[model samples]
Target: MNNLTNVIKERLTKIGKDFNEKEYGFLNTDERLRTPVLITLGGSHAYGTNIETSDMDIRGISMNSADNILLGKDFEQVANEPTDTTIYSFDKMTSLLTNCNPNTIEILGVKPEHILYKSDIGEELIKNKDMFLSLRAVKSFGGYANAQLYRLQQKSLVALTPEQLNAHIVKTLNGMRDMLEMKHDMKGIQVHLKDGEIVVDINVNDYPAESIAGVLNVFNKTLNDYHKNSVRNEKAMNHGKISKHAMHLLRLYMMCEDILLKGEINTYREKEHDLLMDIRNGKYLGEDGRPNKEFFDIVKEYEVKVEYAKKHTYLPMEPDIEKINNFRKRMNLRMVEQITKRR
Candidate 1:
């Protein structure tokens, strides 16, 4: 198997090992009086970021058992209860219905190859690609948007410097770019250095520097916004890791906006936009890859102090003698504190 397949297997193995064996049988219980469908949501599976210890995110949907019991009487009263099947499992019915929904279709379309498991309900939905977007996809995008917002909130409360804050945005954007790549988009937008100058490349059809100037302006403005008004702005600080804005989340938001403009979520927009700008300019790709100059600068500033702290577990400077003397006075040590005897 290739490296990617191996990585997936490793993540799966970690999940299997972490799962409580006793809980595995809980889904099969008939306490709900209906069949249930378990759908895998985000994580390494959905994002293709699965490392070891990745937990599988799942959502359960049931129709036949619950719906038939709760709404069956109404159905019977309306249709006179046909003999073939007067009632159906709520889980089964909802599962089937979701397959044809546009939102559902979108969710299914995201890394279908990553599906670890699927029951009969899943198979049925898989066959109906029409519902993939109308029923399933919107929620996926919504979930991503929510995640991004959450991270931005988290990074706002940290002790990060201006450069650290910029790094946070850079990393976030890179994450989103990777997500776009997974959608089979052939183009990419990247911030990198070329011949000692920062340049944003909007590559189209594998050609770098298509619309370099336009892309650079967008990237520069985005970067400036991140530095000036990101979590570090002090006006919008959060108390968690998310307070640090994620550039990837911002990129995802941009992609989503484009999708909304097109009246649908089409992954091709990323590829197309990326390529459109690529044809406008020709520039060499940077080697550093990540936008981390600010992060490194912050690290350098704190290096000396950090080293001192590492060795002493505290600040290097001594305490003020006056402050110590004042504290001693409070402790009744004002008298006999100094003795000047000629010996």
Candidate 2:
């Protein structure tokens, strides 16, 4: 463990809470908040993406019906922003997610990772992800996936680099490998990365690495040139969504680069990460939180590995059957919904 990780663990324990590595990594949902919540942490840092000198970000979620008497009148105005159809109270956040509102729900949708410091209801939420993942509920909140792709394309066109191009390609391939692994046995795929020529992994009774690498290289070059020109010629507002899979890989590459460069990340300085030049320049948010010195110290004492930034590559023998099906389902549903809504 590094200095920051140990500190975070200590802080959580002091506050009568505990978070495993995965839990800590994705930490900004309603599940982590305390009921009658007071925000002690908010933004990217709390979401497990922090770098250096982060300004400890925090926010409170509450019901609009209750004017948040606990946080006082001054905070009431800040808490007024609705995350969606329902209003979320955030004026005087301490260390909780006590508010239950439509706006809060919407915020939850955007903030994929969050950790609450205190709250009975929030703890209950962690126990039951299914409640929040209803297909109907998410679909009602607007097209989140579409929005993500649109933003990604804009960012990529403006600031892509050679490193980012490579990262994007490798990341996409790995995603395919993972999905296939989860749903099917490793088949005939063989893979190799460019430049390094390192075989990150190999699996195959059949198939050839040359074929896979050829296609990947072709796509990478095309996308690279496309983005480089788009960045120079395009205005930000005129951009639209790119391929969802491709966009995700683009963003993930940007983030991984941030992680590798930042080194240390904590759970209290999310806003600082956002304000960083790298982030503003279209880099991904990584290590955007404050340090928990004590917990960080303990992790180092134990010599635990916190793998926040290492790059990975994977080779698959066959394409993912499940992913193809899921993609079709999602695409079809999205198309129909968009048409119906327009009508």
TM-score of 1: 0.34
TM-score of each: 0.34, 0.28
- Every candidate's lDDT: 0.37, 0.34
CA lDDT of 148 in candidate 1?
58
Query: On a 0 to 1 TM-score scale, where does candidate 2 land against the true structure?
Result: 0.28
lDDT of 1: 0.37
| Model 1 lDDT at residue 187 | 54
lDDT of 1 by residue, 58-172 (tens): 3333333322344432121101121111122333333333322222233444444444344455455445433222212233343455445435433342445545554555554
Top model number, TM-score: 1
**Per-residue lDDT of 1-343 in model 2, one digit per residue for the tens?**
1333344455556644443544333223332221232223444344434435433443444322222233233223232122211113333211111111222332332232344333443343333322322222112112222234334433444344556544644544454444333324344443446674324455455555565565456445545655564655344333321222222322333332232334212222344334333433333322321112442253243222112223221212223435434433443344335435666
